[model samples]
Target chain A: MTFRAERRGTFRAERRGTFRAERRGAFRAEVRDQIAKWRRDGVFEPRSDSWLTGYDEDFSRRLGARGWIGLTWRGRGFADRFVLTEELLRAGAPVAAHWIADRQIGPAIARLGSAALKQALLPGIEAGDVRFCLGMSEPDAGSDLASVRTRAVRTDGGWLLDGQKVWSSHAHRATHAYVLARTSTGEHKHRGLTEFVLDMSAPGVTARQIPDMRGPGHFCEVFFDGAFVPDSAVLGSVGDGWGQVTGQLAFERGGPERVLSTYPLLALTLAAAGPADAGRVGELVARLTALRRLGKQVAARMDAGEAPIGAAATLKMLGNRFEVDVIEVARSVPGVPRAAIDDAVLAAPGFSLRGGTTEVLGVVIAREAMGAVG
Target chain B: MSMPDVEEAAVKVLGGAADMRDAARITAEQGWHLLGVPEPEGAGGTLADLTGVVRAVSAAGLSSPLPELHAPVVLSVRGQLIAPWGPAWENVNLAGEPYDIGDAPSSGAVLTRWRILHAARLVGGCQGAAARTAAYAATRVQFGRPIARFQAVSALVAEAHAQAVLAAAGLEAALADPEDDLVAVAALATASRAGTAVARVAHQVHGAIGVTQEMGLERLTRRLWAWRDLPGEAELEPLLGLLGEERAWDLGAGDE
Candidate 1:
């Protein structure tokens, strides 16, 4: 009887595997068809780093209506999300409006947000009405995020936030901002930090767009002068924001976005690649293939409830390099549009800077490597 | 045995061998070369099983004919194929490893197989180099702290480790579908490129000691240099050009 039961279990597992694979295939096909149609209809122009630069609420709403946003929160797997995002980034879709919310914050809130917070924000997030901008990096806390001086003080039924967040992308248009502020003094720098979701239009909140080389960019400096956030808006727990924010880094850094930020330029490069340029283009594709596989492995690990922090850092490190290298390869190939190359070149610097700087990623990866050896 | 157990066994057996000749003999006696051979004639393990033994041997920094033991003869101008008992011109590569020069028939499939195995070796070499470099960086002290504390040295170690990870990923993809020539070529190209970067960074972090034979970092770095250019990125990269844009984007489609 036990042997028969085990055999039946194995059969069920096999069937589940097959079903998952089929679902993934169908979903990927659907995404490809939709992207092709969008291109044909002039829905959005393909651009490098569209995840950051492209802000089309309508496009995001369409994706949300198709149930592509908040995939993991909706009982879909990371592999499914991986397929969706890979195709979206490959086509350089206008995903920025919903990117931060959908990519990390939505999942975070689902996992750790208060009941009221979930009821208030998750539906809007899934429907593409709620957009989120990060408030982790402050003027003095670029790489050392633990040094953020943003303070959140206790109040009657909420907290009063007083600080400034720099390089908060899309804050000007985001409906919400996820900010990390210190609530109390603790033994270490990583302590006393708390993450809170603040309404963008709160009375004391102000967002000022910072013009960059790209001109009228999404970069913003957000100031909170006694902005009020209810206790329900707190993500995770007080004094544990360090752990929570670090946990989100794997999701932020490991995705296909890190690798495919410059894929539009690569597509253009491939169209213009001559026989002589084949070697160069082929090299880029080979690296991309490897990086994508690594990404898939990371996603699979995440699905299995593993953080895979080191693996994620390694992916971003190599992926950031690949993202920048695509520009040079594009430049070398004749007939690749000059405007595309210029856009990629201007966007290339931030590929390694955002999420985590290359230097910071190197530290993380090397420390992991050292730990393994020891 | 499981794949990791097979690799562990290979490492244990190969570790007992004194030199390349002894290692080759042990490999044959253990039937590792016939791991993927057909039943009755030899053990019928999967390609993945053979990969375990290949990775073990290469990671041990031992130069043997294990990877090519069952492979069909392919051209070797610098003479990497070892056949000591056969009548051939014995030569040494950049790593000072001996190989034999002889005319032999070659097949495209066999070449791809050889490339896959060699790419695995390169992947192993990169891992070995990266591990050793990282270990050294964490222990070797300067300016009252380990050099790894220095961001520059940390960057070097990270580069080596990252390259190893990338190369290993490529090898995994190729192993998944070894029969696919495009996949094999891409894997080899990625591994070959990684080998150069890993070797360079390993040497840089080890400073002058990395070059000396006594220090033993040369064992992996030299092999990396020698194996890297053998049908390296330059040779394998062009094959990827055969793929059109759509196919290139969608290569290894069903497997994913």
Candidate 2:
């Protein structure tokens, strides 16, 4: 298989009165080569079973040297690497370990961190030495995100933090967690919450891992008991965390990671179906192609530093349907014993719920697509 | 390449941002995506299951499809193939077969449903055709290696894909559109023919294995044969027989 030179402007913005598909000059080629090298070196390896995971520190060092961990901006880890992340996730590479810093923390820090904070944190990200976990969702506040009751009130030289966070992915072994805390007591709701960088090893912060259905523990529930973050640790402004959180969410749901989970299975299925399945495979290819087209459109918008939220939701919904269908197709192939269904079965049920639930996407289409004119 | 087993499946529990009032709210809040199901638990369901659910919502009358299903889900997301035809269509007659829902539906309208059903039958037919072809080529021997290695036998298998593609698309459209049209029925007839053609050719290639239980061609072909008759061929039988009898036609003409 040959990797094409990274191409940009592959998808034109509909907003541009006449958007034609075009290649993104030398910059795209350079990116394409970099991605190829990353792929060859297994920079986007499939988390646990990856060939690199075997050697531990050596792999981490290699990753650090290549800037796979902190892809953009010399001192700002996640600044430029957002595209790499979208690519890796879409490619179905295991990014479980650094999932947090790359998606949530890095961006938050780059935008809000002081000169002092940058030096203490960024190197660990470059070297993959600092694994971070997210602490956003709470038992009471699931998708009603503003309901986060985890509180961090002002204190001398620091802030006293206390609250609980559930569904925090990869917390047990992480070096730290970027948590959302309630700073205001009133019902300003979204306006009341704040963001914090919590030291996982601190005496008061406790993280207990939650075992996943078929795999190792990927998520956890963390409880903060009088955990203290000095004034330097608050993420963004105390009252402005809502904007920060939304920005983080945009990063969270806007990528290919949500659709390529079963990529290996797809590859295997295609290989097995062979010449007889050429037609069926062609139909599948069309769906995949459409998905890529849409995805690229959204990515291009982001590259230009625009929010394509509507398109992102649409992509997420599309990705959910296609992802679930891909798994179901694998399940339907005859002769493989039921035991072989594996994660395909376990993951399919939640396909609609993940990312933002397909239902909400329909709402987006309705309000934005249909209601926009009205 | 070898075929993956049909029945094996793992569960993937998924949820999506939910706000039935608007589908996107639900989809976004629920974390709906196809890959890496953002859901906390469970395995996957078929496209038919999920799509069927949406169609059911429309049929239930709890919501008007115009603003909901047709507006956002179909026309907006799936494009205009699903646009509403307005109030003109209510029934239709084709090739002397008069199928009606007691209302005056234009042939274009009624045929749309048939088109969808016909497509489903065709999909089943395509799969059956491919399986039968494979079974035949796998067993028949010539020049020391199985005849499957020969280009002639292989060509039959390739042909099934062409037939299967038509069937699959027809079925997909029928399912996607969800209407009662003759196009769906025609699609079924086409599928049956395509599937039978593939199976018969495969049997000729296998020369015995095609009939064996172990080989499974019989199993595949049987499904194709049965699906060809879906949506009440029996319903059509009386209507067709009555139309064929000249007395009613002549009587109606004389009265007119």
Model 2 chain B: worst 10 consecutive residues (lDDT sum): B1-10
In terms of TM-score, which candidate is strongest? 1
- Model 1 TM-score? 0.93
* lDDT computed for candidate 2: 0.49
Expressed as tens digits, the lDDT of each residue in A118-217 for candidate 2 is 7778778778888777788889765677787889888898788888998776677788898888888877787877788888999888988776775555
RMSD of 1: 4.4
Each candidate's clash count:
0, 120
Residues forming the 10-long window of minimal summed lDDT in candidate 1 chain A: A1-10
Classified by CAPRI criteria, candidate 1 counts as acceptable
Fnat of each candidate? 0.47, 0.00
Q: Could you give candidate 1's per-residue lDDT for residues B104-197 as a string of tens digits?
A: 6578887777777888889989999999999999999999999999999999999999999999998877776677878878888999999999
Native-to-model Cα distance after best TM-score fit, residue B132 in candidate 2, in Å: 47
